[model samples]
Target: MVEWFVGVQVVIAVLAGTAAIVVGLAGVKPNDYTLGATLLVEALLVVQLVMAIIAPAFGNVATGSGLEFWIYLVSAILIPPAAVMWGLIERNRWSSVVLGVACLSIAVMVYRMSQIWFVQLA
Candidate 1:
């Protein structure tokens, strides 16, 4: 995986998480801005997924189990859309909280993915 690409992902994750948290704390239901931010993060995740899939062809193989890394990537990509959908269905402040938690989870997952990409397992 590309280090710079991973860095970009990290930054996006942080922004996404922060946005979610702020929206949640404001005690509003998921609105256009929150949904848009979720979608934006989802878009970035799709890009990251594509880059990850093609990285080995470009000779950027992960030192850990490829399966584990792919699983993390796929999970990360799914979180935002799922959270948004759930939030829309719930239609409450708790929905915003759900988005916040999902975003935070994505942030941690991305960090773990980076470790999997750059570190070798014994």
Candidate 2:
């Protein structure tokens, strides 16, 4: 993955994580603004998924073993939506809690993804 994209993802992840925490702390009422912002984070992941596929396809080693990296990228893409869906099923503060946790986690996955690519590149 490009450094710029990782930078963006990191920035958004931090912001979304903060928003999630705020939402969770404020109680069960869903904030439209926060949800909108959260969707942006997911959208960013979706972009990462697309880029992951393209970068590898073009013989670029954004992450080593392009296909394998994509698998991890795809998993990262799946997690937030699944968490959100699970939250919806419950329809309470816990959903926000899930989202909050998911928001924090993607950053770690992003870092792992970075390591996977860079460690091998080195």
Candidate 3:
């Protein structure tokens, strides 16, 4: 994964997650605002997937275990959609909280992926 792109993903995920949590705390139900934010996080993950596919061609291969990185990326990509589905089905304030938690989880996963990609064993 690209370092700068990973940074962007983490920042956006954190911002979106925080916003969703605040909205949830305010007793807001499942709404477009939270759904859209989750979608944005999912989109970035899709982009990261594409980058992973092509980055090796550019000599930007991971420094750590490729399997571990792929597992993290794949799991991260799935969390947002699952959370969104749960939110849509439940239609409650806690749904927004779920989305926020999912985004935060994605942020953590993405950071782990970055570490796996860029570790320099000396």
Candidate 4:
């Protein structure tokens, strides 16, 4: 788990969340720009996933439950695409709100992933 990579993920999450919220508040339907932001964040998640998979080979094992970490990783990967699909189907301002919530959820999951990687309980 690289600290800098997690930091970049956090920043992307924030930006994605902000974009979604602003679009929602403006009462606009989903647009390509908003969807693209979510897609970009998703792409970053893929990078994070790959890094996590290989981190153990470099001797960077999670201090917390490995199962939990994997669960969070899988959920993080699914969220953006799910939200985007729902938005496209719904075709309303609420779709933007859904995207906002999804982005925020991804941010939380990323933070938890870091905790699982770096924090150990005695």
Candidate 5:
């Protein structure tokens, strides 16, 4: 994983998640703003997926378990679309909250992936 890119992803995820949560709490239903934010997060995850596939070819390698890193990366990539689908189907304020929850979860997972790429084990 690219260190700076990981930071960018986490920042975007937090911002998007916070916005979605606030919209939900205000009783706003799933709409363009919320859905768009979720999509933006998903787009970033897709970029991260591509980066992960190619980074090693350029000499960047994970210091931790490759399987663990890939698992977290793949799972994180899946979350936003699932949340967006649920939001589209439900069309409710709680769905917006669900999107928020998914974004926040992705943020945590991305951070874990970064650790698996960069952190040293004993």
Candidate 6:
């Protein structure tokens, strides 16, 4: 729900997406940097998740309950790891592209999560 954190996610997603595209155009196969991006995003999402918990604990009530918040939390936790692991299985630069897509998707999700948290209405 933090405005600052949503900005962070957008920045991360754009940077990661750019790298993924550049890597794809270069024809190098996927490498450790892809994993690096995964880790970077995971760190950001963890920030979001922690903040999500704290906001309500501090009595910042949303129209929904904490469980709704955790759905986004769990989704954010689960999706990037799955994408990173899938990139490992696929083993192509194209797979990095896929991971980048996931990164962008998470950014979108984070924004949506903020809306779910911040807006007064459902």
- How well does each candidate superpose onto the true structure, as a TM-score? 0.90, 0.81, 0.97, 0.95, 0.96, 0.84
Q: Candidate 3 lDDT, tens digit per residue, 1-122?
A: 78899999999999999999999989999799899999999999999999999999999989898988999999998999999999999998999999999999999999999998998442
Better of 1 and 2 by lDDT: 1
Lowest-sum lDDT 10-residue window in model 1: 5-14
> Least accurate stretch of 10 residues (summed lDDT) in model 3?
113-122
Regions more than 4 Å wrong, model 2: 57-59, 62-68
lDDT for model 3: 0.93
- Summarize candidate 6's per-residue lDDT along 1-122 as a digit string, tens digits: 67887888878877886787678667756678876887788888888777776776777666655576678779878887888788878887788787778887877777777777777475
C-alpha lDDT values of all predictions:
0.82, 0.73, 0.93, 0.89, 0.92, 0.76
Span of 10 residues, lowest total lDDT, candidate 5: 113-122
lDDT for each residue of candidate 4 in 1-117, tens digit (9 for 90 to 100)? 898889888888888888898889899888998788888889989998999999999998899998889999999999999999998999999899889888888988999899988
Put the candidates in lDDT order, highest first. 3, 5, 4, 1, 6, 2
- The residue-by-residue lDDT of candidate 5 on 43-65, one tens digit each, is 99999999999999999988899
Residue 60's C-alpha lDDT in candidate 5?
Answer: 91
RMSD of each: 1.4, 2.3, 1.2, 1.2, 1.0, 2.0
lDDT of 2 by residue, 1-122 (tens): 67689878978887887777777777864455555556777898888777766775676575355566667778878887787666667667767767877877888788778777766653
Residue 121 displacement (Å), model 1? 3.6
Which stretches of model 4 miss by more than 4 angstroms? none
Q: Where does the lowest 10-residue lDDT sum fall in candidate 6?
A: 60-69
TM-score-best of 5 and 6: 5
Off by over 4 Å in 3: 120-122
- Which is better, 1 or 6, measured by lDDT? 1
